[model samples]
Target: MTRSLHSTDRLPASARAGHWNAVIAEAYFPLDLTFRDAARFEGQLEHSNVGDISLSRLCTEAVQYERHRHHISSATEEQYLITIPRKSPVDFRQLGREVRCDPGGFILERGDEPYRFSYANANDLCVLKIAKPVLATKLRNPDRYCALVFNGREGIGSLFTTMAQQIQRHASSDPNSDAVLSRHLVELLALALDRTSEVEQGAGSSVRDAHRRRAENVILRDLSNPDLSPEIIADAVGISKRYLHELFAEVNCTVSQFVREERLKAARDLLQMPNPGQMSDIAYRFGFSDQAQFSRLFKAKFGQTPSGYRAQITAACND
Candidate 1:
């Protein structure tokens, strides 16, 4: 069930700092907080768990938040949060990267990393907290996206922002529907990130990274094509087969290995869905020739059979 946590007027201003700090800490993570108006601190947070992700709407006056190394070391789970401001901009600094994220742009943050995120005035924030494993399924290396701002005002980004707003507006109508909506939001986020990553890769100074990203994107879009191969991918990405091999070698993997891992991760994500269909269908969707081969490779990578893994996660979600 969804819930709201707010600081009330019943408590005098002098006593609200601890309460507000505790509330924010539990809702997101433990952070050193200094309110712009500590004596008159005002904040309200509404949050819920959407499948394996956490969705929250945080409205608060000006404040400075610092996630110190101590807090980062004490954290038990690794998560990534997408923070979208409503009116003001947030100055987020992490891992030698300092980013100023304004409205219509979202910041991707890592829970395991120490960072400072502060806004000057009162601000409304939309945050989606996703577990590392959940996000890793949609990304090759999730850490690379941290502390970066992706455009949320056009195309897939626009759709993703619109979906988050809708979910925030109607998350509690029905528990079942909320779960499904949450899943959709996550899917949209993955698409937005996937697209943004490709663009950034292409724009970077390294032509090798750009070619690799192009090739990877092609492989992702055509995962279901059994005829997919290094030659097809190289041609589609406008690179020679030898050059493609060299590029992937930089990542210490071959084209076939990359394809296999992407398919397996995709299949793993599909398996965790509330309505994951027949195992054979899932396998075929990821371009596996047959269910038997898919099951063998899946077990080899994840150390469990597909059915067994799904049953385990299903039971865990229910619990």
Candidate 2:
């Protein structure tokens, strides 16, 4: 379904700010809007839901939007915004880092944090509001991509930007199709971000980052192998075992821990399928030695056992 809000509609000038504030909050989240001229402010927004993601196109006059700590206190879930400016540059500051995203670039903003985003000129923007957990499944440490400008004019970034516009232009009315489209968009986004040189550009040397990326790919590919370990990954990537361990340590996790977490995430994805299969089979497929251990670890990480999680999803779908 599609919905829209216009500031110029029959609403009174004095009521425009309050009404627009409510519309912005309802479409995205609570935000403090400071219009260059509140009484003469002009803006328009159209929003639609794509599965668990919210997509919106906003056009507005000069304005500054602020998400303060108090506004975050009322948020029921943690969300991130991927903003793409179409007509002018956008200035965003978050996590002590600031960036200016040009028309051919995009930036990620953390909704749970305090940030100031503004544009001095009239601007048109494409914004995606997605929950953190939903994005985490596709990319590890999604927050690392925040507050950085990404090229949307070439490479995978261009593909992602094109897809987003296409989805907005031809949004499916069928809920199931919309859900699938949302998943594809997020997967593409993860690929675009992961392939970028900026992914770990600030972490260390480019050579070390390249090796780490290779190691991660090896782990993801051979996740079904019960013996997947630091030694095996190191050998597969032509790096020493100690070097592999050191690489992972730079990210504050051991190789074994990364493997286990990936397995759990894969298993959870399976459980969400229409036919997830028997618990034992699902666990074994992910290289879990036994269903009991899988259950314990899954619960510890996701706050629910496999069966419980599936049941909850089932109940929600039914409703």
Candidate 3:
């Protein structure tokens, strides 16, 4: 597999900042920048050339920036923008709520709204931009998932950080891997959106909690059966397929989808263990026909090919 590597130090001054701006615009709302000290701002930004889905990390020096309503055009599409600050602090406003994001705090932005963000001193941030249409099609209610804050230090926020780090690692190794990474990226976004909707809707019994639990148990018990599916599980639980589908509708996922996800998760865990079983053995145990199928599904679910994932785990264990 051919891979492309990009390091910030290798880019010119203008292209570094411009590249960052382009990623921001693609993932969130647009920004109209009025630099107070352009010459004073120095940074390096590196991005993979994967169209539609791009991943990049950046570090910027002291600078002032303003994002306004004028930058958002009526023709603009909706999307989700996630900002994870690695250093310094950032201040931004959304719906009249002023927020000061500390290091490691995540800032979520909506592409359909107008907002402003500013940073002082040197700062480093990791960003993930998701296409709006893609997200909307995946969620039960897309509008309700926008402009939400996720605390990076705990809970689901921590999951996002883990995913970001994983992506950065794979992306840094090979640019062609973006196609695989994008799938994991989308799954993470879906999980984030689902959790955000749950938070905003307030705490209820968690729609379909019982059904989801039952389905999860079945998945865990029968992970080695590739034939396991929503219909089979629903029948085992004495529920109709339609009812089972309705149950998962609350979380914006289907029964079969969740089953596949759980299987993939189990595979990942097994592969990460010390002296993980042989690739073919693990695949067979996890209900996959062969290593090829296992690798394909693993890449789709975790954003890295199975071999890549296994090698990473082995390297970490040796270290």
Candidate 4:
């Protein structure tokens, strides 16, 4: 499933950097680059797209790169490049946050935001270029993870880093297996980041985490109830209504927002099934009071109505 996007070995030494830049833009998003050593610059980029997620590895010389206002506006897809560098450190700046991640650590770089990501030396980087919404489904408000470094060598991070390394080494996995593995990778990455964020939040971490999980479980179980609300979910999970609202607040989200997002994600997945059932039934089952409301929200969130998404994704898979 691996596609060799670019290699210096194919081109004459003269155009290595130029050709490399073009290949990178084609596979990943476009970005402005200032080569540290233009004349000597050479790099390699190979990628495989599993589902909508990209597993890419780039070996390159030092370069100062920026995804600025122009690039952000021109981009088609919103993504977060979860980087795991094997050879050198990456200095990334985003949302007024600057962080350095050495080998055995990783950072999130947003494509929708202006940011700087650079390696001061040659690097062999393993990056999972994931769609923003795909990652968001696993972790709430993923933007807050940007520009922060997490130790890839610890706890769940250890498993995540190891899996990425193994996947790169064996890039010949079939599409179906690769897609499943990629989803697991995202889940693990989200868990590691959530755990890290919790630890940093000090004493309140455990309570917040407990409440959040319980509340989410209630939401999932009662998604078909159009009347489901923060109050209902709170009572179901045995927490005060105000406390439930505050718990979601700590994650910079509202309970209703979380519920809506989960519903949309659920609808999207059901649509992709072999037989997704009647559209109206699917909508009602996910707590949408009306089919039209479901259609509008689906289109707004996923850029396509439920039926359109099903048809388009199905066709793509067949191809």
Winner by lDDT? 2
Best by TM-score: 2
Local lDDT at 102 for model 1: 93
List model 1 lDDT by residue over 181-258, tens digit each: 767887788888878666564433255577688999999999988789998997787545655786788789999999
Which lDDT values do the candidates have, in the order given? Answer: 0.82, 0.85, 0.64, 0.81
Q: After best superposition, candidate 4 residue 81: deviation in angstroms?
A: 0.2
Which model is ahead, 3 or 4, in terms of TM-score?
Answer: 4
Q: So what's the TM-score on candidate 4?
A: 0.61
All candidates: TM-score? 0.62, 0.63, 0.50, 0.61
Which pairs clash in model 3?
none
Q: Residue 15 error for model 1, in Å?
A: 1.5
**Worst-scoring 10-residue span by lDDT in model 2:** 198-207
The alpha-carbon deviation from the true structure for residue 15 of candidate 2, after best TM-score superposition, in angstroms, is: 1.0
> What's the residue-level lDDT of 168 in candidate 4?
65
Candidate 1: minimum summed lDDT over ten consecutive residues — where? 199-208
Q: Is candidate 1 or candidate 3 better by lDDT?
A: 1
Q: Give the better candidate number (2 or 4) by lDDT.
A: 2
